[model samples]
Target chain A: MSGSSPGSIERLLGEREIVIACGPGGVGKTTTAAAAAAIAASRLGGDVLVLTVDPARRLADALGLKGLGNQVTPVPPEVFQAAGETPLGTLSAAMLDTKQSWDALIGEHAPDEATRDRILHNPLYQNITERFIQSHDYIAMERLYELHSSGSWDLIVVDTPPTRNALDFLDAPARLADFFSSRLLRWLIAPSRSTLLGIASKPFTQVADRILGTQFLADITEFFVSLQSMYDGFVERANAVSRLLADERTSFMVVSTSETVPLREAEFFATELATRGLDIGAVVLNKVLPTSLSDPDALAATRRLAQRTPEMTAALAARLDVDASVLDRVLETVTESFEDFAVVARREASSRERFPLGGATLLTVPQLDRDVHDMEGLLTLGSYLLGS
Target chain B: MIPLAERSLIFVTGKGGVGKTSVAAGLAQMLAFQGRSVLGCEVDAKGDLAAAFEAPPSGFTPVSAGENLSLMAMDTEASLREYLKLNLKIPIIGRIGPLARAFDFVATAAPGVKEILTVGKLCYEVRERHYDTVVVDASATGHIVGQLAAPQAINELVKVGLIRSQTDWMLDILSDPRQCGLVIVTTPEEMPVAETVELAAKVAEETTVELAAVVVNRVLPERFSPRAEAVFDRLSSHEGIDALSEVLGADSASVVGAAALATTMRRSRVQHMNTLRAGLPAGTPLVLVPYLFQRADGHRATRQLALHLAEEIDR
Candidate 1:
């Protein structure tokens, strides 16, 4: 094994009840989460569910499925055979349906059929459910908490939408709480309260009514009135998510690459997780360049190759019917090939310095020559992730 | 090549972590260098553009970045507030703090409201002639299509009211190919290339914006000679290790490994580049930006990328 044991990731998969994979977008967060969940299911002998927010066709392609819907799709035994791995336990995945989840949440939490119908049919609710800020994050957390408490799977792997920063997901519950508790909601629920305040505020309502227009204001007032009875249900759900995330069995796997911007985001995410006292299992750095060329002897070898530029040009000139001037350029290409490795080695060294992850076992996956387009690639990546 | 400099509003978006911010900044710099007053706006509210330029945070207001460049970090809340104050033209209680808070809460809950406000602000800036070129560093590809589509969606959804009137003007400029354009920035990798192809199709079908160009960032320059390939092929063989060791006067295994590693890097780059070229739409301009050996994070790196883009597009 390299420096970190292969069991580092495996430990998180087997021991923890919930594993959340998070990072900035395009760093292979979805692939990492899917692979780990699949390996844990097959190796650790437990039922695992991967809840992904991946785009429509991405998860299906990764899991080698025909198509994926919001419902759970189990990984078949044939897939394990195709991946060259033995199947043991069960593996299932579901892509989050943001709007559907919101609708279902309203149905589950509404005080009565009348209120539920009113809220569902409201133009504002219809619009908000589809495009609210971090609605995906908020609903995903709700779904994770719900599924976790249901005792359906031994381990649940949640993949978050790549937000502007990791803090958005961490801060989602509190932000939702704030939005729910704002004074505006109270006013919208009971506009009559404005008259109850004082005589000084009496004219304010008229001005607002005139500006927002009477119908729009009434629509806002009606929307809140219908949602007012369900406010406690929302607060309770949000609190449950917060408490679950802070629980001991819940673990977060921070994934990123050894690049400056991703490392910066990883640092921000890790630091925020630490501040929240959430357990960070490992910092999975993907697409890392090899550190071999940084050795002094390799550097000397590259320099030696560069020193033989004249002979290389002569040899290339003798081999091809080309002009003498083009031969030197071709020779530089040969010598500089070695120099390319040196450049990447130096860049990775500098990139490593910018990484903020500390104390947690750092797992590095070397850059693969090809993109993982199928289940075979996922299994290979999973082996690397599990340190096999 | 896409005539990006001529467009009033240029949207730069791609998959996350593909250096969209830097590409947007580099495009802004390139345009500014040509004497066009550029407003580099980041719509996701990450505000990394200010940091990339080594300037203080631009907040939600436009801050002068360089001689001809300006930067703004778009905040949906702030944009909503401005929309109410300016567009609604309400008299007295509209300017109150609680009203803005109320608007923010309701708008945040409403789906297209936030997007309309954000894109509405950008479109407003464009129509106002605020800058010669307004380059927006948009959010990830998944959300950006909806952001760009909001004006047209609202235009179709709400036929009357002040909202409809406001979105109508924005939609006119957005759907007009001359006024607005989109540039996709992606690495020469498999997933991003696949995503970019899908994105191009989606933007075409869902929105009025045009896909102006595709900037293939961080591409390795494959300049290997036949002799170099032959040498690498020999070093990869069993007996060639001893030959390479004799040639280098050092340990052959390490030298061979380095040579093979170099060859692998070049081969992968060629494969990715091929995937991108073959996959993207025909006749669409593909601008190849060389991979910077240094870290692509700082202002210097961004300016260097800008220079490369300037030369590539001109050619």
Candidate 2:
């Protein structure tokens, strides 16, 4: 079983250079990642960047910025100052532009200008970059590698794309290789009648040409053959990305709430991370029901108070010569409120017990009465996360 | 009301952790109960719908999960093989393990191919008239728009081929409102509601899939009447607290604390519900699924949601 005491997230923030926050959607994973980066920059004295690709754009609004794009923009010092914190280091953030990153990756690796233009302008490649299922996943890893290699930030926090797709980023390299190494491309790209291999594939080509019209085959062959020179670069980059993710300095953090579904996703994420041989640093359990009222003595006291409510109301009514029914209604409402909290607190605790991160650090963030949408809110969350 | 039986496919989607799977399962059961042969399907999902329906875990082929309901979990690899076998009529290649693996690798690498195959298979089921309804517990809201648009996007790239033909059929099924529609699930919260509204607009812009209804899950019940609210307000006032304190003595603090918490909870719930309604597209049908205060059990809770949907659909 995981220990009951919440572990310090500040310690991990100070120690790890790369923190990847992964979890199901709607669990505030992006906000938690952004808060971690902001705190690490202001309180711990290090340059930090929080990279997010969330379509919801909550992170941008939370940071009080009008918008974010592919470019890494510095978070104005005034924002931090307004929250009563002066940053000793720099805090910058960016949202990944999927297509721009894909275009850039190709531009940097293509063998020549002609190859680059051919692939860039190819209708099929254009469709692939825009509509490919894993383009977002692959480009996210590509950008992370680029930033990590740039060596500007002392610490970087990644707000991974939500849910299972985030896991797709973890295995992107292998999947990318599988796509490139498949024999189908070889058959498609085979030179026409120049070698014995070409003659051997003639029948297959005929069938393919018939099924997918001659023009279709020609387009596909052009798309694949144009990239033949840059295939090696893509493969090597994929391998480098995999290595970067598995590096000792990289840590994976799972963010979740104490709901049954989110906890299940947390456990699944932790298990997947472990299976990938990556380091699991901490699990941030957010919006946990308040534990203050969960204590046995407190529960007994509240129960006794509820039981004595009618008597107390009667005595008050007699002393003040007021309507007893008004007091009675008010007393019942107050007592029921406490009882509701108690029930929720107990339910949340039981749900938390089902999370399976026994050996990993556990950090719990209590639910706030108001929604967080500003720097002050982030810092307040930071204090709770860092236990300061 | 959108007729569930008339549609060949229903794509249920929402932001994660908002009970999309439960809503899909409940809708499946409700449709099944109405004497329609329904197939509950999930793509790249972890047997959640299967467990919710208390059915055997699904494989590539649809299996009986309940009366009038069959279940299948679609994957890129399996759907790719199925697609190849159906399109190319090559049984030997699909039977050869290594050959099948190679095809799977090729399909995996190609972007939009997996999504096309998955959607294609669902469309294929409808075209074959195998089931009265195919309910897909689709991907999360963030990616579902892209998934739905993949086939048409690919069709634009490949103009003349078997691939184009297949994608055209898939698009046909998706664009026809009587054949296909979408059910968006959400919670009475700010982010989910906002996402749901944006998703509705995106779907309307990107695809022909019509919005069947918005299912609001975990809606907190209204607990206070206007009279009770006024009374609670008076009790919380300073002079009122002092007067009550004189009689209640030391117990006044506990009572006051409880009152504050209760007020906070009730106020937030009302705030969230109002936000949800305001953010949604006007005149969109809303199904209110109450918050189950008890611990959540997949099967039982799904049934509760199904019962609710049944009533809503009947109304």
lDDT of each: 0.76, 0.76
lDDT of 1 by residue, A1-388 (tens): 1343443588888899999998878889988888888888888878999888863364576664454446778878787887777867888888888888888999998988989999999877776677554787888898888889989899999888767556677778777877778766675556444542332253444444433344554565667777778888898889889989989899999999877787788888898898889988888889876666666776676567567656654554444434545545543555565566667667766666556655666788877866665667777777787888
DockQ of structure 1: 0.38
Work out the iRMS of candidate 1. Answer: 4.3
Chain A TM-score per model, please list them. 0.88, 0.89
Task: Indicate the residue-level lDDT of A327 in model 2.
Answer: 64
- Cα interface RMSD of each candidate: 4.3, 4.0
Tell me the tens digit of each residue's lDDT in model 1 across B1-315: 337678999999988888888999899999989999999998876668887898887878898989899999888768866776685566625456655665575566445777888898999999999898899998788788889988776665554556667877898888777889999999877678878988998988999888889998887776556755665464456665554455567654654565566567667767777877887778788888987775567789889988999999988
Native interface contacts retained, candidate 1: 0.35
TM-score of 2: 0.90
In model 1, what are the clashing residue pairs, if there are any? A127-B111, A128-B109, A128-B110
